[model samples]
Target: MAGLKKKMTIPFARVPVAINEQKYVQEVLESGWLTTASKAAALEKKFARVVQAKYACAVNSGTAALHLGLEALGVKPGDRVFVPSMTFTASAEIIRYLQADPVFLDTEYGTNLITPGILEEAIALHPDVRFLIVVHYGGQAAPMVSDENQAGILEICNKYGIKVLEDAAHAFPARLGERMVGSLGDVTCFSFYANKPLTTGEGGMLTTRNKEIYDRVKKMRLHGIDHDVWDRFTENKPSWEYDVVEAGYKYNMPDVNAAIGLAQLEMAAEFRAERQRAAMFYYEHLGQLQEFMDLPVTRVPFSDHAWHLFPVVLKEKAPLGRNEFIKKMAMAGIGTSVHYKPLHRMTYYKNRYHLDAKSFPRAEKTWQGNVSLPIFPYMTPEELNYICKTIEKLLKY
Candidate 1:
């Protein structure tokens, strides 16, 4: 066994800055026009090309992207949307933003992802549901299209006329078979939050093939202004003469943040590869402890996954509970976190919808033991070894 080194702190996540991040930001700084200009436009073009989408709109956050995408998809007041019980608050909260209700569904046990069967069952109960927000949980793409033997979420939703909005917040640069996530759903949203697979400090993107949806989101992202700042400023027309098509939110990504995004986008493939390396290390080191804990499960190859998180669910027979295990790991200088407590268990959702623990059996079970360990790009062998050894010591009774 490797000796546990004292005071060697490993954060749950660390953004790996790309070589061009500084250079691009410097160029943006020198350009004088910094707010939502050429850099942001460049990012949108490059991002769309990379994801194989017809159009891409860069926004300030993933939540903003969701809000805009839902609005564009005609999600109106009193509508019901299907969301997974095991995701960040942003997934369900966006539904509420449109004055719509979320019908939270239980996820698959190990993946914490809402499967095609779950979606079909929910649709059976709520036949009026026309919208669905499919979260690509922890960087694994949910089964969107049907296969030879079974119908997928997209196939099932299409039958019921459900508009699918993919929350690809943790799944940038991920693929489902040959198609990347951004191009798979009706509208796809990606987060560039500090700790995500790609980071622009605080930024996001929305991509879609429908020209109407694309135009709606593009106009609405910046206070419903028909003309973007770049267009107004660059064109020969008057910069001040823009029309407000509708009352919209201010969710445009700035040139500075977009500058960062450009650099990060360039290194996205490299970053994903490094993350996969770390995941492989964890599997090799901790595979023996499967009896005591459950590691993340994915249907696709590990290389296809974004590898944003490597969570483990401690079994009933483990030496310690989830909280205790986290504390011990912290004491050993390793940082850990819980991906979520599930929206069904949250006080607001529970009180509003009268949710019951029995309603979400898989999510409930997974939540009890969920602990997301440190996984990031460029993690050293020593760091990986320390994390694995610590888990072994804690779990091996």
Candidate 2:
């Protein structure tokens, strides 16, 4: 029940900081064809190549990418998908699109993905689980789905035929083994919002190695058109010849947005370097504050972190709780936020799923105290130091 010992103001996130984004937008302005056409196609190819996915389909938002991924992977109205309680609602919300239910799985205190043990337990108990949705919260990789566990989960899912979808919205360039995030799970998703590692203002991509899933998602990303709309009118093709294979949402990413994404993607290396640098600075500096906070643990041995957000958990300390600490930081001009209130605890999810607040102790405690401090590619080192110093001064009582 205490406050930040004083006042200061720091931003949480600022948009479009990628090095080559602006020039790309200008080039797109002159490219003539705009909407989900040429630029979008090229971006999809570049995105697939970079992420190492056999196929990639650009869409309007991370949520759209998720929805399309689910649809293509055969999510149905009566299906039950196991999802982490600790992720953004977008991860769970897509399940509702299929009239399917999200069976909220708890997260470990140190990272966002659902536990392999609890997942095994859940799979055993719920024979109806048709899919597993793993969210690598704040750019951290999902805990490995070991061969044994994979066989277990996949066996059960395969018995009833279930698919695994990974919500990699934050874990963009993260790796697992020799594969990148987008290629890790059955289908993985990435975001390009104004605030992501790569920003297209508002866009996302869904990736998969499975030909059927990828092809279907590609169609679903558009209006479920049997073929690419851009190709439908290309050269000598008749404009009126197209088929609505199956009704789908208008989630396609436009060429202009792809133009921005193309530019941002080109600079992914530099962008990734800076974000990791910012995280390392935060980790090196903030890790010393163990008396006050806990840093997220990385599972990837040589896995590259996209370092999307530097979420630190405040340990039990003198005179301050999580919410109070956030208020104090805000008062001091340092912007901060809790990554999420566990999805199960939200009114709609609770009412629908009958999810009790106390069901996920780890995720609950994590959400209650987790503070995502400002970490971005554009943040100056001095700014980061100022934040650490500011928090240091504040913890004094």
For each candidate in turn, the TM-score is 0.98, 0.92
lDDT of 1 by residue, 150-196 (tens): 89999898888999999999998899998988999879999999999
Candidate 2's TM-score reads 0.92
Which residue ranges in model 1 land beyond 4 Å of their true spot?
Answer: 1-7
> What overall lDDT goes with each candidate model?
0.92, 0.79
Residue pairs with backbone atoms closer than 3 Å in model 2 (clashes): 7-332, 8-332, 8-333, 9-333, 10-333, 157-162
Question: Residues 59-140, candidate 2, lDDT per residue (tens digit)?
Answer: 9999999998888888889888998888889999999989998998888788766666678777778877778888877887
lDDT of 1: 0.92
Q: What is the TM-score of candidate 1?
A: 0.98
